[model samples]
Target chain A: EADIYQTPRYLVIGTGKKITLECSQTMGHDKMYWYQQDPGMELHLIHYSYGVNSTEKGDLSSESTVSRIRTEHFPLTLESARPSHTSQYLCASSEGQGRNTEAFFGQGTRLTVV
Target chain B: QQPVQSPQAVILREGEDAVINCSSSKALYSVHWYRQKHGEAPVFLMILLKGGEQKGHEKISASFNEKKQQSSLYLTASQLSYSGTYFCGTEMRGGGSQGNLIFGKGTKLSVKP
Candidate 1:
């Protein structure tokens, strides 16, 4: 099993509340990513980091922001949550050069903004 | 660009077989296959790099065609545990060192016992 873990496997909060989704991996992978997925839908990349202090926005635009101050942690935060932001967020990490590597994923956090 | 997957959904009986195909419009450096069960994160099945390589894991196998910029996943003797959504992620040749993956919409596979 993958060593990656996400906190608050499920969350339901009121609108306008600030929330943070935590992701941590013990694999010491340099590449980490956050993806948003709706029920039974494809995953959309929201943010990714190549390494510590190197973050990039993915193809899909997202209001949430992520930080990678530590190699093993990549947490995503929402300034103010909205119902529109309600979706499952998945965290993944891959070792070696990103080119030919396979990503291992966490269990994912299911966010439900009310 | 995101890869395109054919046969949005498929249904099969236990012990049957199925094939899922993914195609990219741009040249690809690699193709990755992942399976996501209900209410869970996607699990990586395998990754196929350039050179038209083929990889297999137990009853699951995949083939990559570099020239066609396409990849196919084959599941023989499907099991109920194989019921899930399958996604194909493509990494473009010039997608940078990070090799960010752009995924297809996904194909849902349902296996009935």
Candidate 2:
């Protein structure tokens, strides 16, 4: 099993609520990513980080923000959540920019905004 | 560019054979294959480098054609455990996009007894 972990496997909250999805990895990888996936759909990259204090937006436009002050933790925060933000958030970590490197994913957090 | 996957889905019986194809419009650095079951994270199957090499894991095999910018995954004598959504992630050959995978919509495979 991968050493990555995501807290609150499942979450439910009201609209306009602020929430943070926590992701941590013990693999000591430098590349980490956040992907949003709807049930039974393709995975969409939302955010990623190269290393500490480095973050970038992905192909998908998301209202959520992330910070990587530490090497092992990358947490995504939604200042004001909405029903449209309800989806599965997956955290993945990879070692480098090598052409053959594979990413390890966490269990994922299922968020529901009512 | 996002690679396009063919046959969006396929259903097979145990011991049957199936193939999933992925093609990209842009030059590829490599190809990554992953399988994800419902309510779970995706599992890496294998990676096909730009050299157009073929890799196999148990009964699953994949071939990449760099010149053609295409890849094909072969599943021989499929097992029930192989049932899941198969996704092909493409790494385009260019600047600013390294290590980040642009994934296909995915192809759902179902294996029945």
Candidate 3:
């Protein structure tokens, strides 16, 4: 199994509540990413970080934000959750520049907002 | 942009063979293949860089045609363990330094006994 890990494998929160999905990797990878996936749909990149203090938005516009203060930790936060935010959140990390590197994914966190 | 995957889904029996194709409009730096089981994280199978390279993993193999900007995954003698949703992720050349991949909608594969 990959060393990457996502906290709160499953989360249930009321709408308007704040939540943070945690992702950490022990491999010390320089690239970290957060993706949102729905049933029978493609995984959409929401946020990613190349390294500490370097973050970028993905192709898909998202309401959530991410911070990479540490190489091993990249966390996604939503100030206020909504029904539309309910989805499976996956975290991944890749070594080196990412061009030829294969990404290792975490187990993912399934969030439900009501 | 996301690549286009053909045959949104496929079903095959053990010992059968199948092919999944992914096409992109942009120039690709590399193409990665992954498989995800129901309610599980995707597992990387292989990566094919430019120059129309081909790589194999066990009974699975993949070929990238840089000229056509397309890649194909081949599964020979499919086994029940190969049953899962197959995804093709493309890394466009100009995407940026981060090199994040843009994934296709996915192709569901079912291998029965």
lDDT of 1 by residue, B2-84 (tens): 89998899999999999999999898888999999898788888889897564436567888989999899989999999999
RMSD of each: 1.6, 1.4, 1.5
- Candidate DockQ values, in order, are 0.80, 0.75, 0.84
Model 3 stretches astray by more than 4 angstroms: B52-56, B95-98
What stretches of model 1 exceed 4 Å from their correct place? B52-56, B95-98
Poorest 10 consecutive residues by lDDT, candidate 3 chain B? B51-60
lDDT of 3 by residue, A3-108 (tens): 9999999999999999999999999899889999997689998888888998999989999999999999999999999999999999999875734678899999
Say which prediction, candidate 1 or candidate 3, comes out ahead on TM-score: 3
Please give the range of 10 consecutive residues that has the lowest summed lDDT in model 3 chain A: A94-103
Model 1 chain B TM at: 0.92
Model 2: CA > 4 A from native = B52-56
Model 3, C-alpha of A60: deviation from truth (Å): 1.5
Q: What is the TM-score of each predicted model, taking all chains together?
A: 0.94, 0.95, 0.95
List the lowest-lDDT window of 10 residues for candidate 1 chain A.
A94-103
Q: Give the per-residue lDDT of model 1 (tens digit) for A1-114.
A: 899999999999999999999999999898899999999999898998888998889889999999999999999999999999999999998874634688889999999999
- DockQ computed for model 3 against the true two-chain complex using alpha carbons: 0.84
- Candidate 1 structure lDDT: 0.89
- Expressed as tens digits, the lDDT of each residue in A1-114 for candidate 2 is 799999989999999999999999998888899999999999998898888998988889999999999999999999999999999999998885663577789999999999
True contacts kept of each: 0.76, 0.66, 0.82
